[model samples]
Target chain A: MKIKPECATCIIRQIVDISIEVTDDEIEQFRLVKGCMPVINEEYHNNAVPAWMGTVIHRHFKKISNCEDPYKRLKETANDTAQNYIEDVENKIKNSDNELDRLKKCVLATIAGNSIDFGPFSISEDIVPMIEHTLNSELKIDCSKELLEDLKSAKKVLYICDNAGEIVFDILLIKMIKKYVNDINDIVVAVKGKPILNDATMEDAENLKINEFAKVITTGSDIIGIILEECSEEFLKEFEQADLIIAKGMGNFESLTEYNLNHKKLYYILKAKCDPVAEFIGVDLKDSVLLSNKQLQKNLANIDKN
Target chain B: MKIKPECATCIIRQIVDISIEVTDDEIEQFRLVKGCMPVINEEYHNNAVPAWMGTVIHRHFKKISNCEDPYKRLKETANDTAQNYIEDVENKIKNSDNELDRLKKCVLATIAGNSIDFGPFSISEDIVPMIEHTLNSELKIDCSKELLEDLKSAKKVLYICDNAGEIVFDILLIKMIKKYVNDINDIVVAVKGKPILNDATMEDAENLKINEFAKVITTGSDIIGIILEECSEEFLKEFEQADLIIAKGMGNFESLTEYNLNHKKLYYILKAKCDPVAEFIGVDLKDSVLLSNKQLQKNLANIDKN
Candidate 1:
């Protein structure tokens, strides 16, 4: 489904909002949007930084009486601003010899990655155990007959990742998917297009060497759920052909749920990371994991058998 | 006030942290030397983005420890990542016609600005009103006189600004100074050299056309108080000759107070923008104007007159 322009803008803000240490309430504002991070990238293509600056500039600019596309104008300005900053950093890097100094700048350059608003600390802490229980037990697998049968028919699999600190786990999931899928090419791992939040981007995938094993793609949308609307033609084609899509983190769940995938199998694997999502799924966000019924049952039985 | 290396690094991280929104207090839990931001910036020459990514690469590369400068290695990798992302955005901008589309990209670019953490919205909100009060009041005129007097004898006036949203006000302050001082060459408005907590950054200043009036500067330091140690020689030279320094926000107050300035006639004119700083000065952060005793008395008397 195509995302509304306002919704898309809001989602873009939301994804970036998530990576920061902003209050849980502030972060919660973004949680309302599904699949947040991908939208931010999508919005970028639409709105430039200087254009974004134009919005702030709008307040300063006296002549423009009616700003029909304030978001657009602001974005263009933000783009100009960004380019200048990138140049500034480049100059700094050219002259500096201090390792610690260089490292801080690299980290600062990776700023968007850091803005992942985790929401209230309490909400974040509260839901971890439940999500852990689900991912560790109900979401785990022993290659059950029913699940394997389903997997045999699966033509392709898309694994969407979230958060840099948690990226190591995503690699583990990719490793697990290789066990179920025969065609390596059929397995697509979608990291962030850019470092919108502390999630693995295409660069991160290359750094982590995930690109070595699988074709890495960014959803081109910032929302957590699968945004069919913003997906590039290439991404969309893969998504359309995919038999199974495994979305990691709350962002994927939110964006994916907005659309009607009909019979396509979609699995959301995330520790209810925030309250709005936890409440939506009828589980505590702190510790709950929402999974495909098939994955949940198979993993639960495997736990029972073990 | 020379910023310590540890403090510089921390401040740089804080600036980046706020911009990227790295909230997990743990992410900020770095070993301090003096100035976290400046130390890191010095080591890398103000290129912290690559440095930040290097830290992550260091985390992984250290497993084998073959690379001589893991940080440098990481810096190279981050450069590749940043370049790719930059190219991607440039490509999109090249392809798109929608002004709104470009605006989104601009916002994406300013993700660094977005990452800057203001701690909590509540904290920022609580203190902003006082600053607004001072800005709105006639009492501001009295302090401006002292500030202007201090600036007149000085070769340069370093006007430190904070908060991106609040920067508009800083512009007004700079305008006031320009109107009174008549020496546009002497005015230097230093924003965050890097993005931190939505503070007025060099990029923001540029976008806002801050340099159109004054020489806008950013310190490599991220200390919360008056950060002099992390600044460049160009800035330091101005600092040395300055008859007066006007600090605009709470972070400056926090970072600057620790180091003793040899009777440099520093005037910190901010509405008690935070509780800790307000408490530090033994005033109500919510309602007080932070000025020297003489300026404070004059401001209060002016308040009574009004």
Candidate 2:
């Protein structure tokens, strides 16, 4: 979860890209990339988390450009794009033979939606094809059966959403979980408190009516994933209390894995897009993963005892 | 070639790669990338040339790693790899029906050899398949016949060498120029004075017996391409005096094109491997370019007149 040496280049590449997007003035673009180099120089280290560094650099970029949300339009477009695929995903999940099949299909659809990423790595911007690809592709790290078993005892399920367009598909999964996992007393969806890339915000979740399926909350800060310290006390209580947490996207995997949160149920659902994440997850780049952070959680359990 | 914003990432990526390669020590890798950030921060700009910044940062890397010629093993491997392909290339040229076919084959084979690159961009290190690929590919901008016509009246030629392995193929092109273009009085093969990447040094040129084909000299500077100011007075004099300049590889294309050199006959013969260089040549990426700097040369002529 710590930033790789390669992350230095990728993060800078993103800075350059966003800087260009934030302005037409070449001098301004130059100034933005120029100014952010010090931030990267200061923060890019072995122990720093990539997404944590991303937040630092992106905040610096926004301060310089006077852009409140660089990816605002993209998030809107992504929401619209994913809107078209919802019915298709619903139909595919409905076609499942049994509850497990239906649930797995929903998970796959959500993982497919994770492809609508604007991270340092390139993925297919075209949505439905990726939907089709993900549905057909087997998860590289499947723990859906374990997820199903955990649902049996779970009182609260917290779903952390990633990108906006993809959040539409996530809505499908939430609906499926609610309909079938009837024992679950609560379903909570957490979105970003502020805009970062295409990551869904409260406004986006509200526009999508994510509250129709579950209680919606923000991470309470605009850092990537759940940096526990940055989260609101209310959100942290929910994070601590949740029996099963469904975390979407690479950013969460990157940010959350840094802590030894023992006995916490964290499910990382994403497509392995970059070398660092893929290598850490022991999967090929671009492979779909529905991974239980059970291993980390259990390992930390023993570490805590020792 | 003014540095693209993307170049910031790429150059840093190169730094990270070299830092890792230079030392197995993780802390050292961190330190090396860490130490070089200031240099990148200080020099990376819209106006800076990528290769020139490469020189600056690489010098900084060399200083930190306390390593000389980080790519020395790869260079040796490249030379050995290319040595195996020379006979095959020579045979292909020999099978040509006429002078134009033979000469063009030589150029194509030479361009194919340029694929043995270890820059930030990924290229197939496999030599012969690229040789086959290049031979099959047409010059996106063909001026081989023009090169032949120019050769008829040329007094001296300066053949700038690129990577170590590719210099093996350059030897063949130099031989063809010598044999067919008999009116040429001199042929000078210029290589790097010190090692940078796999760029041919005098040691590599000498090892490959390039002296058998033409007189060999160093650029008098280890910097990428022809930084005319940094280059030795002797090499700069040769650069100015040579009637036809056949520059090999992207580095030469990057560094040499910054000058006005209004009347100079500079043929940039290489594969257009990156976006900036490809755009400048008006060719697609990975296209073979036997590009005459005629447009650049003539455009500057108008400016000079003004």
Q: Best candidate, TM-score-wise? A: 2
Worst 10 residues of 2 chain B by lDDT: B120-129
Per-residue lDDT tens digits for candidate 1, residues B1-306, read 122111222333233333222223322222121113233323332222222322322223223333222222222332333333444434544554653443333322322111122432322233323332332233221244454455455666777765564554345456545654556777888765544334555656776687888987776544333446557777677677766677655556555555556366776655443333444454663333436435544554676687
Candidate 2 DockQ score? 0.72
Model 2 per-residue lDDT at A206: 88
Give the number of the best model, judged by DockQ: 2
Residue B295 shift from truth in candidate 1, angstroms: 7.0
Which residue pairs clash in candidate 2?
A78-A165
**TM-score of each candidate's B chain against the true B chain:** 0.53, 0.92
Kindly list the per-residue Cα lDDT of model 2 for residues A7-87, writing each as its tens digit. 887788788777777778877778889999999999988899988989888888888888889888777877887787778
lDDT of 2 by residue, B7-54 (tens): 777788788887777778777788889899999989988899877888
Q: Give me candidate 2's interface root-mean-square deviation.
A: 1.2
Off by over 4 Å in 1: A1-306, B1-117, B120-145, B148-155, B220-226, B293-306
